[model samples]
Target: MVKVTYEIVPHDGGWAYKLGDVYSETFASHDEALEAVRIVVQEQQVGDEPVEISYQDESGKWREEYSDGGDRPEVEIIDRFRPGEASV
Candidate 1:
């Protein structure tokens, strides 16, 4: 069982969505990541990728994170944009 870390990061232009990151090495295939995201999104009722979720950690601090499948897309670099402006 590979554990993938999904992060819901803020989009500089459009709305945020689920993004997946691999957390474990148990599964070596991309399909595993996709399956995990499909299940999590369905169960969590998230409508889009990079879904935002809040959870309490051992220290009682609330943490927010976004997660998704590992096989979806690749981000070559971070980007920033003003509202209503076309992405450059």
Candidate 2:
């Protein structure tokens, strides 16, 4: 199983959560960002029909692959900042 993590971080003068290079929209506050994470994780748990996916590699080659809808990565959250320190 693939393990995924959402790390809370300061971004663009606001708070956000990021999974690898992907980031959620900036929220006005840390609590708001956390709430967004909760929603996204919930959606991630829902299964869907398997589908073929395409993506570009680092070498700029396009690749197609099949993804199993039943397979969901285990999610983790990391929030290192204390309440008042979250502001960017």
Candidate 1 steric clashes: 13
**Per-prediction backbone clash count:** 13, 0
Q: In terms of lDDT, which candidate is strongest? A: 2
Model 2 residue pairs with clashes: none
Tens digit of lDDT per residue, candidate 2, span 1-88? 9887888989899999998999889999988998888788889899989999999999999999998889987887788875543322
lDDT agreement with native, every candidate? 0.41, 0.85
Tens-place lDDT digits, model 1, residues 1-88: 3333353334333233243542322333334434444455455443355566889999999999776533243222112322332111
- Model 2 C-alpha RMSD vs. true structure (Å) is 4.8
What lDDT score goes with residue 74 in model 2?
88
Model 1 regions lying over 4 Å from their true place: 1-25, 46-88
Judge candidate 2 against the unseen true structure and give its global Cα lDDT, from 0 to 1.
0.85
